[model samples]
Target: MSNSANHIISVSDLKKIYIRGSEHIHAVDGITLDVNQGDYTAFVGPSGSGKTTLLHLLGCLDNPSAGVLTVEGKAVYDKGKFMNERELTKLRRDLFGYVFQKFYLIPTLTVKENILLPFAFYRKAEADKTADRLADLLGLSHRLSHLPKELSGGEMQRVAIARALINKPRILLADEPTGNLDSKRSEEISDIFCKLNREEGLTIILVTHNHALAESAGKMVELKDGKLI
Candidate 1:
């Protein structure tokens, strides 16, 4: 299959199965999807509907048991052509940013430190200017020196967002990013995603159960029982 620059991710007949004793649970079955560059797509599903599993697979956090999965026109997982752990790590670090329901920031680190953690991991020089710019955009410039404990829930989530973007990833995968926030904070987070998508042309794939939040995206896909409906 040919890969297009506009298609950041493409998958066909993707399947992820887990065997528990004699039971075979198909977390994701026969999912064919394409995520275009700069596209904001949301996946909605009930609990146990394989939304998270699908996200994980797309993010290269997990391997599929069967199917073709490609990122940036390169096949990352296809039968015997799976990427190794180190390559997967590099792919995730350089190409993808992740945000989750919990703002997984280090409690002891200041906002600036937390945001720069990815640089430290990659042993790359700190991009203070970029960090500051992202902080300003996320409304966290004033909170740079503050620790996670001192920030409000919304502020913490913003910090998480900044940290995720520190690597300047092409794709941002958010799984229930607004799940822990109040309605107002949730809206704020949703607005941030939209703003980033519009201003920076960031490709975003969000998995959310909230109809309002899902509708904010340019595309909405529903998954039920490991299949798109």
Candidate 2:
């Protein structure tokens, strides 16, 4: 439990249950954690341990079956109820940026186009300037005009990172960000994450099996059977 004023995210007894016919699967069960502003936290566990599910809940990508989730001192979910979808969507768009294991980039869209896709939902002042700065920060400035198919695995992931940052989200949620990369490429991504947290002051929460990537974070949270261990 964290009581600091800077705690950006807080979860208490969070649980996610899925029903498959008569069987109930507890993907995330009774987990509690706190994430401070600009904190780099890694969630590590086995394949069925609910790491990704937890991340989804935190990012507002999924709803929890039970729990209290507080973001930035506001209650998003409490006592079996959640914030309305409109507000949740705003939180997802303005407060959290997400990156997944798969690049999820459109093959036909150039890197710049892919990075700018989020702008279709909400307008940003000087969107191009913001994208350009993110591209430079993520080392994607030179490859912005190339298609996803033309880039290496590392470059593609960098573009994804830039896209996630274009909204200037306060938190970055990544699930198995380096799962598809070679060791060298994975190392590069790890370094970029470090720079994002340390230099750019982005709060990063990631779920990963990669030991080196996990070690780079300031905090390590281990999960097992959907519970913190």
Query: Highest TM-score, which number?
Result: 2
Clashes of 1: 0
TM-score of every candidate relative to the true structure:
0.94, 0.96
lDDT of 2 at 59: 88
C-alpha local distance difference test of each model: 0.91, 0.92
Instruction: For candidate 2, give the lDDT of residue 137.
Output: 88
| Per-residue lDDT over 1-229 for candidate 1, one digit per residue giving the tens place of the 0 to 100 score | 5346679999999999989999999999999999999999999989999999999999999889999999998899997579777888789989999999999999999999998877644335447877899999999999999999999999999999998998889999999998989889988899999999999999999999777799999999899999999
Candidate 1 has its poorest 10 consecutive residues by lDDT at 118-127
| Top model number, lDDT | 2
- Steric clash pairs (candidate 2): none
Candidate 1 root-mean-square deviation in Å? 2.1
State the TM-score for model 2: 0.96
